[model samples]
Each structure stands twice: as structure tokens, then as C-alpha cells.
Target: MASEGSTPQQLSDDFTDLQKKLQVVIEARQRLDAQLSENQAVQKEFAELDDDANIYKLIGPTLIKQDKDEAVMNVDKRLDFIDKEIKRIEAQIAEYSENSEKKKAEIMRLQMEQQQQQQQQQQGPA
Candidate 1:
């Protein structure tokens, strides 16, 4: 079943097409894996933040009724540091989300481009 009309260029194009498709799949999988790792890191950070909040709660009641000014001052200093830490964590979370969105968009664009190339190849003369 030999087709005498088939050109070597067509066969080469087909091999290139398969290679591009495989590359796209590999890149997409890598992106997904990176996203998952980022998500886990975010989750771990949130857990640590929750632990800090619990510490604040545990100390709040004891510090409220204390008459020692020096002790109160120390507690206030610690609380200020905690507040700053919370703000920093919020900023980090926001940055992570923004970066994640950008990565997702990039991956989507690449996938669409790959699909369009495959379609064009299918429509081209054999």
C-alpha cells in the first residue's frame, strides 16, 4: 500500500507536529505540578499564621487585666510585631495569587496556540 504521491516534506511535517504536541503536553504537566506545589506552600504559610493568631488569643485575656505597666508594654510590643507579620503574610498571599493567575494565563495561551497549529496542519495539503 505505497502512495507514490507522498512527499518527504509531509512526513517531516508530521513528525514535527507530533513533537510539538508532546512538548505542549509536557509543559502543561510541569505547570500543573508547579501550581500544586505553590498551593501547598500557601497552605503551610496559612497554618503558621493561624498558630500566631492563636498565640495572640491566648495572651490577650491575661494581658487585659494585668496592672503591671512594664508587662503590658512588653505585650504591646509583641502585638505590634505580630500585626506587622500579619500584614507581610497578606502581601505575600496577594503576590502569590497574582503570579498564579499570570502563570495560568500563559499556559492557556500556549495550549491554544498548540491547538491552532495542529488544526492548521490538518487542513494543509498532504
Candidate 2:
């Protein structure tokens, strides 16, 4: 509940801030999710390569030849890091989602209270 002297304007501003924060979290989560999927696909591709197959990595404008085992190792390391980041981002999303719901509820409750006060004013001398 809003404390005494808390104007409707302040409450509205607070609600809007939460909305912006929620959107930012959602966008970040989406980006991490896409990256996670891409890394997983790369990991699968690396797994399918034969032991003797050659690998090339693009460095700037040049295609540099890389050892097959070395390429697999690099991809595997990236995959592990991406997996961890994905989990962390998911946890952040869950926490922000809960906060978003709570803020929305609080805004609703405040609006309802304001409406009641207005109604009471209009029904003066009751």
C-alpha cells in the first residue's frame, strides 16, 4: 500500500519505471535465449565432424586453418559458457517477471482506491 502523502502521480511514475525495467529484462532474456540456441547448434555440428576432418576459422577477412581437435575444444568451451549464461539469464527473467506482476497488482489497487475516493467526494453529505 502507498504511504500517506503519496500522490497518484508518484505512483504512476513508479509503475512506469517498473514497466520499462521489465521490458529491458525481457529483451535481454530474448537475446540470451537466441545466443543459447545458436551455440547449441554449433556444438552439435562440432560433434558430427570426423576425427581427421579439417577446420577453418574466419579471422577478420582471412580463413585460418585450425586443427580439428582444437576447433572442437574451442566450440565445446564456448558451448559450456553459453549454457551457464543462459541459465543465469533465465533466473533473472523469472525474478523480474515476479516483480512485474507485483507492481501491476499494486497499480491496480492504487487506482481502485483513488476511484473510491473520487466517488466519495461526488456523493457529498452522505
Model 2 superposed RMSD (Cα): 2.2
Off by over 4 Å in 1: 1-67
Where is the poorest 10-residue window by lDDT in model 2? 1-10
> How does each model score on lDDT?
0.51, 0.78
Per-model tally of clashing residue pairs: 0, 0
lDDT score of model 1?
0.51
Could you give candidate 1's per-residue lDDT for residues 52-122 as a string of tens digits?
24222237456343333443455556556545555654565465455545544554555677799999999
If scored against the real structure, what TM-score would every candidate get? 0.45, 0.82
Name the Cα RMSD for model 1: 16.0
lDDT of 2 by residue, 23-62 (tens): 8877877887787788778778878988787779999999
TM-score for candidate 1, please give it: 0.45
Query: Which one is best on TM-score?
Result: 2
